[model samples]
Target: MPEDVEDPMDYIRLHLLEKLQVLLTTAALLAVVYFGLGRWFRPADPLGPIALLPGGELGKLLGIVVVLLVLAAVAAAATTRSRPEGALMTALFGLGGVAMLSPPMQTLFWSYPASMQSLYLQMMAEVLIFAVGIMLAEGLGGLVRSFMAKICPRWLWTNTLSELSDQQRKTLKKSRIDPMWDKNILNGDSLSVSSGVRNTLLWNLLSLSLHGKNRTAAQKQVFRGQLHRGFGCLFSGVLAGIVLLVLLLQSPERGQILFALFGSFVLAALFAHHLFPVRTFFVAWMIPMLTAVLFYALAAISGTGNRPQYQVLPIDWLTGGAGGAILGFWLSGRWREIRIFEALAQAPPE
Candidate 1:
């Protein structure tokens, strides 16, 4: 007789419903901000020329995006009833909606008179552009994966998971530990372990409870390896940002707060990785994420040329370092791998 399996789908459905409620609540809050507070802080009179592409069109675009998002959520719920990935998709849709609506948030901060319908229209247009940009980003990720699979079939999971030969299966069975069949695609690269450690570190930082190890000394090695690998990742971000800045060199009133916030996120993540060599959930995921959010807020404040914003960036850095350590430690426990935090925590006290 087959063993009874507990359905994860039921839990997923419940979570999806909860997320939908949260989204609806957020939408209600936005509506209040747009209608209530926006009336009091009206900005300058409409002095700009109206383009052939009107603002109402932008609002219509947002409505279209909302419809598409709803469809995605429905498809995710229907297809992934029993899968955790399905629930994750639902969350992604909810987050995407929030990002799409963020451009219009500034309108709530200030009031506009009836004469400045053009200003409101311009705001709506900007919101649509921003939403489209974010959507493009999400689409680009999928496009890259598609291209990778087509050009490097062996590296893609599609080919990696092909039916195994009898000899291959027998060889795999002989090993005491489970073999990573995907490793074959890497052609025995020496950096594979380091790469795995780097990827694991990011995941661990996000959720300290992901599958990990118990040994402390080994975990420390993994942390060091991840740090080494992260150097490349860090530089890549800086390089990409610099390149974008260079290409779009116009001083179009770029918000200091945005840069500061992003900078703080990077700083915090780096700090967390270096400090708090403890393997617990609280330290890794919670600290880093909180630090990132705080950094963003501080950067926003700093962009206004407010002096207090400078101090918060340093705090963000420290929190990030703490988060990294906590994440490293927790990852060690989850993956049964060596991480720096685990090693330090397990060290003999003097």
Candidate 2:
């Protein structure tokens, strides 16, 4: 007789139901944003341009419904931990958000008589775009890294144990060591560890916890190698910001420019901070804000002659940038710590 034989199907069913609930909740939230809130805040003019898209208002409504459905599906797929599923979701959400703000949609909505009201609509649209962009960057980061690993030069790719043979990988798995730790192993010609203590924080933390005494030289070397791959998040944020700015520039209003600049900065900052695994909230939070400020200053200097003057109050930056920085820092810390706990749990007992 099989001892302690639990039915795996029960666990599978439980997980399936949990996932379904999450999907349903996400779909409901999206529906509220698209239908309830959207209608409540819609412009006073019933026959606005957005209302006149092919098939009229009903068509636009249906389009939103379709998009929401797609988003819900993507959200569910993202739970699977599958790279292709995540990549597809990322592309679909990111591109769909951008498409929603295309020229035709803008032309339709911008015709509202109340400028402030129209600006509100634009702002909401931009928020959706930013949200999707962050999701895409996060979801696609690993996929992009894996793809690069395959094509990158031998010297570059060999630094990580991701190139380990099947037997070696299996051995590591049996020992309860996460494959992700392989990212920190240096197999290249150089003997020294990668620069920057922050780069190997997670590896070091894990190594010290798992093997307090008699740590091997190879283990120490692995801890020194850089592991976190964050370029995808940065690239996605920048690309999405550019697309949003281009759309906003269609209207040369000062409000539009200010909103676009602030929104883009927050979006980029959030993604970058989230991707970085630093424990110091202050460092992670400030990096993105500082980067954004530098970029803003550069833009200001370059366009000094041609750009229209807008009085940018200090409070604006403090409120927007600080708020986003704090949120991103908190979220990243929470998520990173959760993964650490999971890894710790999997470690072999002393």
User: Candidate 1, residues 1-350: lDDT per residue as tens digits?
Assistant: 00111223332344454445434533443354345432222222332111112323444344434443443334223322112122222323333222222221233224333323444344334434433432432233233334544665443222111233443333333431223222331222122221111223334454345534553665555555444435533443334333333343232222333333334433443343333222212223233233333433443443431232322222122222222323233233322211211332333433
Each model's lDDT comes to 0.32, 0.36
lDDT of 2 by residue, 77-143 (tens): 3333221222222322232222222222234324433443333333333333333333333334333
In terms of lDDT, the poorest run of 10 residues in model 2 is 189-198
Residue 281's lDDT in candidate 2: 29
Q: Which stretches of candidate 2 lie over 4 Å from their true place?
A: 1-266, 273-276, 305-315, 336-350
- Predicted model with the maximum lDDT: 2
Against the true structure, candidate 2 has what lDDT? 0.36
Q: In angstroms, what RMSD does candidate 1 have relative to the true structure?
A: 17.6
